[model samples]
Target: MLIEVIIKQYLDEHLDAPSFFDYPDNPPRRFVLIDRTSGGESERLPNSTVALQSYGKSKYEAMVLNDDLKKVMRNMEELNEISKVSLNADYNFTDLERKQQRYQAVFDIYHY
Candidate 1:
């Protein structure tokens, strides 16, 4: 879970919004939720596909938050534990049923 910690800490420091591994009972108007969708090891090194969902008061706000996240995420390789960071995809992942505006950014993170 080093990558998780690295991502969370990095985002927490660099982004304007808060980030969480689990959704909070009382959430902020804008935040980011981090999830490790899939993962595996290669020769003892770890790699994972992480999904970071940004929620905002409006669709435009969500998109802006996601963009800001992307900009910072691309620089995660500078951190110690993370070896590489690659964006897989990012899109509107709004909760239509709940009517919550959200955007999701997926990434392939390789770490030692």
Candidate 2:
């Protein structure tokens, strides 16, 4: 459900945004990728962690998109079903070409 909500929000905000894992012949200059890389469960309760990455041609553009996502996720607790949606510190990454860059922000969703 968290992934669904996130993907929906991104699409609603950015019409031209690329969908998750959508490898095309020629990708856009800017887009997003969301994946649930890891999670934890105990006593039938679960904690889900997702990686949200904003890719861009420039460092500033990457950060700006990443920050926009962070702001929207900051108050996601309002949904009530999720116990909390918190972000860890973010880090930037660059390709081997050093021409493209991305900023990754990880979020932990405690769903009730």
Candidate 3:
């Protein structure tokens, strides 16, 4: 949840953007979803990955938001004493609506 909280906080403070942990019915055209994926643990440390997907009405719009988010997270590899978040992957797709474009930014997070 550290990754989720850190990402949400950053989006809130910097962009004042709408973000969610899971998909919801009729979500805003412009929004973000932070989803936790499979991960592993070594001793007491948890190494996890999360997906940050930015959605918009157009591909360029989504890309713009994702790029801005990436810039903001460039040096945030460290979230706090408990977690470190690093970018993993960047991808793009369309939502079920087809009209909604989405750009995904995945991150790997490690917690002590």
lDDT of each: 0.93, 0.70, 0.77
Residue-wise C-alpha lDDT for candidate 3, range 1-112, written one tens digit per residue: 4656866777777664588887768877688888888778877788878788888878988999888877766656544634566789998866766567899988886765
Q: By the lDDT metric, which is better: model 1 or model 2?
A: 1
Model 1: ten consecutive residues of lowest lDDT: 1-10
> For model 1, how does the per-residue alpha-carbon lDDT over 31-106 read when each residue is reduced to its tens digit?
9999999999988989999999999999999999999999999999998888889999999999886699999999
Which model is ahead, 1 or 2, in terms of TM-score?
Answer: 1
Writing each residue's lDDT as its tens digit, candidate 2 over 1-112 gives 5654654564455544554644345767877777777888756667788887778778998888788777866766766566778886578865555467888888887766
Candidate 2: where are CA atoms >4 Å away? 1-19, 23-25, 97-99
Best by TM-score: 1
Candidate 2 vs candidate 3: which has greater lDDT? 3
lDDT of 1 at 69: 96
Off by over 4 Å in 1: none
Give me the displacement of residue 78 in model 1, in angstroms: 0.4
RMSD to true structure for each model, in Å:
1.1, 3.2, 2.4
Q: What TM-score would every model get versus the actual structure?
A: 0.94, 0.74, 0.79
